[model samples]
Target: MENTKGISRARFLAGAAAVGLTGAVLPAGQAAATGRGHGHRGLKHRGVVYTVGAGETPGTAWSAARMRGDVRVIRDDLHADTIDVTGDGVERLTATAAEAAERGLHVWLQPTLGDVPEREILDGIAECGRFAELLRRQGASVDFSVGCEFWLFVPGIIPGATVLERVDNLRKGNVDMARMQRRLARFTAKAADVGRSVFHGRLSYAAAQDEEFEPVDWNLFDVVGIDYYSFFPQPADYVCELRRHLRWGKPLAITEFGTCAYVGAPETAGMGWDIVDYTKEPNEIKGDPVRSERTQAAYLVELLEVFESMGLYAAMAFEFVTADAPHRPDNPRYDLDLASYGITKAIKDRPDDPSSNWHWEPKEAFHAVARRYGRRAGPGGVTMAEEVRAWTGPLS
Candidate 1:
């Protein structure tokens, strides 16, 4: 399985304690995470999302050994108890979920199919559901996601054949919201029924923060999830925005949330990755954005506090690594990593040995997450002060 990057798909696997994550989390005044409540609660699952491509690609060409190694890093180094394994291929998604489950990490199997027809997408979800049921029957903790942000991915929902075109249509007010809602209702209900027939474990749908998500019949699923992202300089009562979703009486999960590795990136939040200029020979950021790993780290910690205050069920960081976007520090314009939400920066080249290009270096966010998520909340949960006081080490 040689990838387009010319990297070998070598066989390798290691234990969780095999390697320790080193690095100090830069100071970003600790947040009062246990605010509204005296301690952290209603949040059980905490970890990072990992994605693998369907076939040969630059950073996502995953081999068995590669998948094993990455899962070890997530469980051990990152101190994540749960992993949201997502991608297009059913085999890859199931294999990765199995690996994570073997390592004692809860697996959220999400099939993200973009720019595909409705029937094909539904079929893909059904296949994933069947596989997930097999894993669960084998004693693995697995959950199935029908699909994510369908308005942007599934065709016929929006008036376009591609994701960008669909987005453009929405931007130009070309969509019929009422009709789209009705169609979404039918699609989601069918998806839930399809998944329920196969996967017996918990089920959820990763929703985008939009009106389209409003029409979903959440009772079909066990958990209400959203890939929540908003710009920085938030309002004083920002947490209240999500209160509407809580009305379903279902546990809410912040399926994805994080910012890019650059100053002012928090202001753009989810759209920060748009800084890349893809037309160039070696793609680069559009502006001279100052890289700031601390900004990304602090924003994530701050949101953890907000989500905790809201007493949500779970909150998984947007991602653990971005393989395609490699770190290029020589020139700011050439540095694609500044726009990456990955806590670990993928290194593009190694002059000393070009063969070792698969290496990555953790950003400040990695340590910050390790410190925050590393702290386990007891039955009654613990306050921010108690969590800090009980800290054992850097990655404890």
Candidate 2:
């Protein structure tokens, strides 16, 4: 049900907010670890977003055992040090966080609830914070994301009851830019207050780069989380646009970044998946979209290089797997994997096909990411322990 044609999610929203208004990294003295550094020095938190279903719908449900398996693949196979466990429901977030923690992966618990009332959203965040604190107390390296793209998901900002309605509200330029900005700022400040009350770890919100509205108050967050995706006609220097976050004196993290697995997807970035017809039960490609895992792999590697050059605190690829978008090679037109940002292609379980029993298979991007993150495991690069220590720094 999510659609953002052509410009990454942030730009798409930024454009929408233009009718209305607009929208950090690193600790100091650690300048060497951040900012334009020597060849791919690597980020302390090289990560991938791991989505845990809230189990509200059948497609979103997955057992803890399967979730743990995915966590292992992310760590042992992908060679990623951090896992951004994002989803709705505190219980779901906590379960996934525990799995990531058991694997020694840095857990960024992001509770992504959409279309909910303001009070429900705040209560959900508070509950997530409590669960996250439990994980931290149990020795798991954890951070809590207060919210993700509040303007779209949080009501009262864009005057829509649902996310789609909000996006449409923006698209139609039927919003009060200044009023929305004020509401967002106040809501974010309040969210931060609620998060800090229970969660005694690093806190952040995945903010979009708005064209008109002022940036979120970084004073509320320990890390500046940007859900950055390349602007099509790709920018000359990714860092130039990214550098503004550094001025806040907080460690910067690319909360989400990546393109889909189809030809020309890199050009579209986040909106590459817009080709899928989400109106039906089984989403299908609208047109003859060519499948190209190689393109997807190259796009990710290219961005990782950019993130490396900038010396970020972390850069979590938008996602690891999209279970609902299963890979149906026999039927290319119905192959939802083409629209997926997941590095791994999920294979629907089948009793007759032994191969399908494996659950999923790695795409070219999986190995590509492994090669990039693997480089960090070498001498003079950031290790898992180091990443965790740096992320879970003295929580004050």
Model 2 clash tally? 12
- Candidate 2 matches the true fold with a TM-score of 0.83
Find the 10 residues in a row with the least total lDDT in model 1. Answer: 8-17
Per-residue accuracy of model 1 over 1-396 as CA lDDT, tens digit each: 221111110000000001110111112232333222223454577878787673334334566787799899888888888898876777788789888988999888888766667888889898989988988998987778887766556778778787556656766677787887777778888888998998888899987554333457788899888776665455334464566566566777788888888878776535677677767866767967878887787777777766765667778897777776678777677677787778888786652232444767888888778777776654555444443344343321
lDDT of model number 1 = 0.68
Where does model 2 exceed 4 Å of error?
1-40, 55-60, 211-214, 231-236, 280-282, 350-358, 377-396
Give the candidate number with the greatest TM-score. Answer: 2
lDDT of each: 0.68, 0.73
RMSD of 1: 9.5
Q: TM-score for model 1?
A: 0.82
